[model samples]
Target: MTDDVTTLAWAYLSRVAEPPCDEIATLVGEVGPLEASHRVAAAEVSDALRERTAARRDIHAAEADLNLLERRGGRLITPDSDEWPTFAFTGFGGAAVRERPQGRPPLVLWAIGPARLDEVAERSAAIVGTRACSSYGEHVAAELANGLAEREVAVVSGGAYGIDGVAHRAALAADGPTVAVLAGGIDVLYPAGHSSLLHRISNAGLLLTEYPPGVRPARHRFLTRNRLVAALGAATVVVEAGVRSGAANTAAWARALGRVVCAVPGPVTSASSMGCHVLLRGGAELVTRADEVVELVGRAGEFADEEPRPTGPLDGLSDAEKQVYEALPARGVRSADEIAVASGLAPTAVLGPLAMLEIAGLARRDDGCWRLVRTSP
Candidate 1:
């Protein structure tokens, strides 16, 4: 199919199609996107689906997102493109062609950042847990992510609060690429608190979303996103989760995909670790470090990590973050607005980096502003 036709077709379908919809996936697969688009436009499909398509057949939003994302250094990758995550499309996710398939993968993935999606997904481990993770859960998550990073294994996680944030931070701190699978549009930073972290991931790692540019993260979207996380990675690791949590959902998806599932043991008394224990008892392997995770996801000796811990806090920050740090006056405080102008980034963008800097002990926040912390002994 022609590039223009293919792009516009998938773009339109993506906006209107409810993802993981087996019917749409099968239809598009049997007949190319261009033909499928024609079918929908001609009212040859189901009345309900045709009505849905008619309502969103105007590709303005998707086209706008394509232009905006390209300008921002990202793109929409489809099955025809080499940058596509073929494993997710063809692996367990794509099984059951003869019978009615149980599930389907995304038609297109919006990727933002420096790392290539194919490379990042090649040998990845997903670390997931509760938003209100405990200290032990947080520590184990960092250890696993850092170790995985040192071995060139890209870390994958929902870029949310708690364990997910810790996993992304640890991988970035280790100077390896990490993919943030956002539930919402890549342009709309949800959880607002992790904007700096997510921005840095997009620069040094990768940002992935199945949603359109302006789509907000709905509760259902998160559940759908967990499957992508499970499908992209070779193994899914539940660091800490409640009895019924998103981490558990990822593990379930991994198990369904016939992928390895691992869980770290937490204190028996802790509520956060209960999910991990459940997975452990339900056939998930017990893993403590990155090497174990690597072994499951890679060939022997590949991604073997001799070093497990990070060197220091500032080691893995993105260039943008480093610029923000450099812009800080050595002896005085600078408001976020001042830092934004100095660093050539927007004021809203500055807040995330500032928050991260403070967490890294490289900067401190005073009354409504920030200042660098003394590092010399």
Candidate 2:
């Protein structure tokens, strides 16, 4: 395996290709990066793929990117590098990501700043919300981030406006390291207006991305980027988001990755809070303060480091009951019809287990419907 060739090829591909390329990631995973790079260099690719790879095969391109990163006081963090976060296990967490449409691990990461990636990723909490957020969201995000940072926990967020921006600034104000995980190239100052905030993150905390220089942010990239933010955090907290917002997507990814997920409730009449409410109803822990977030993430991190809980991985719930319980939300409620549909169980089939679950105190019935009893689990 040619390490240098592989490294340079990953850099080259990162520039030419869109991120989270499932096919390429699978190929690289099956073969080592070196062998995969050699294959692409040899044009051992399908006709459709050859065109893309052939057009971007500049042997010198990776060198230029390296030099640029060096000048910017940054470096590449590849899977082989010690700086790579371990939580990025076996490429994109676990078996769960393979089921996703755009769910693959990043090929290479471009990083700028002082905070170590693993340390920042391991104990962090991703605080994300809508870019056009309400004051309530802003306040919640800032306070939550501040509390976490002041406790010496790293705060991670995208450097967008509203909730993300507030999260970063609050962390800094607390004199704690904050990481900005960008969707675009690390060098590209997205939102253009938040250049100063990005600058502060680069200097005082950390700035990271999978895209190479000159790559601009795209709508798909931001959605795909959610997984990185989700993966970095031991727990992910959503302050507020629209019904169909990116922050909600981040929460979904966190659930898929098995990271602890939490949601901060907001006014019922506010559309900005819909996503958070949805998440809360979907079983994410409900948190309203910075201390709550810190405790949630802290216990989660501690649990992650503990010996595997003999909760038998099934958490002592039978499959049918587990299905029914999962269908119920952490807040609000779900009707039997909804639970049946979600659990893919017939109404008749669900009735018995829901009863048993209620007896076990894992679920509670309300007005003929049911919901998961709120628990730290």
Candidate 3:
């Protein structure tokens, strides 16, 4: 019965690709609706599937693999299974099912991990960003992942390069469990370069996919998969992204689901930082350090060491100078406007203290913006 239900579900997903209701209804009709709530109008479903001829073919091919896997003694998990992830079910329920043409959730999820999906994702955060991330971006991603892991928080991300790669590596390096939700089949590492990382995650963390083995990733699938990343995590953080990058899609999905969205602020001039800045301006939490990321996850204590201590050269300065110094970030540049906002001081008051700090070599201007510089001999 599990086999039959699983096959029918896989076949249905293969048919609809992007949640087409008519195709799903047809499959549900053949499969007997597995559950009563999974139904939609056939005509509306058909219209939604009007332009997906190629996707339909891909679905058929994947169905064949499901049959092969079943023959090999592999088990299937339906929504009714005891092993089915409760958190995923919650996401399914919270998802905008009304907006989808199919009016159905995923047939079943294929997973390989020691921890149950719900347990692993009890307080998870998705770290997503560009494949071509800068060094600064990678550093921030690693710090955030490491902090989350040390706090026993699971880190979730796409198993891609740049930021994702760094995030996974940091979590693993810290001996923390992480989950990699793929756009392609779990068996097929899309970029190919991260095969080792994928293997490590399968052993130490979890590897998940909606697609069956041997299926390759398609363009639309990547966008569709982002929703899973957002839905699975308690919050989503974009370390870096281009203005129109897919990370934005994840942020949007997170927002729609009422999940906290966080972004690491980078150099204002960087093209990669543009997306994060946009997110920040749009009300996403502005995080320059890992503690800020942790705070968003309600795990601020995990990165307490990264927090600045109330001491050092500023200790010798007056209360007003200390206020100005405390206002400046530990790294990167900030305009006077930012300092004013952060310190709640007028621009006139900030200017006097800014000069005093500069003379003391505790701060310096780079490219017309002031930054807190570490004192040196």
Candidate No. with top TM-score? 2
Which sections of candidate 1 miss by over 4 Å? 51-55, 88-102, 299-377
lDDT of each: 0.81, 0.81, 0.71
- In terms of lDDT, the best-performing candidate is 1
After best superposition, candidate 3 residue 99: deviation in angstroms?
0.8
For candidate 3, report its TM-score. Answer: 0.65
Give per-residue CA lDDT, model 3, range 1-377, as digits (tens).
Answer: 87665556554554345432445545555655433123321322344344443345333444565665455334344555566654332232344643553233455566666656777766788999998899999888999999889988888999888998999999999999898888876568777999899888877888777666666888877876787787777789999999998899988877765577888889999999999999999988766655555555664223222334456566678545776887888888898778876875556567888889999988887887899978753
Model 2 C-alpha lDDT per residue in residues 52-171, reported as the tens digit of each score: 666665454677887788899997888888878765422324565665646666788898899988787767899999998998888888889998998888998889998999999999
- Candidate 3, overall lDDT? 0.71
* Candidate 1: clashing residue pairs, number: 0
Candidate 2 vs candidate 3, TM-score winner: 2
Model 1 residue 64 CA deviation (Å) reads 1.2
lDDT of 1 by residue, 1-377 (tens): 47876887777677766565566676798898878877766778877667656666655465787887888898888888887765543333335622333246687888888898888888898989999998888899999999999999999999989999999999999998899998888789988999999999988999998887888999989988988898788889999999899999988887776678899998899999899999999978788777778767874122222423335555698655776887788888889989987876556667888888888899999888789987754
**lDDT for 121 (candidate 1):** 82
Any idea what lDDT model 2 has? 0.81
TM-scores of all candidate predictions against the true structure: 0.74, 0.75, 0.65
Ranking by TM-score: 2, 1, 3
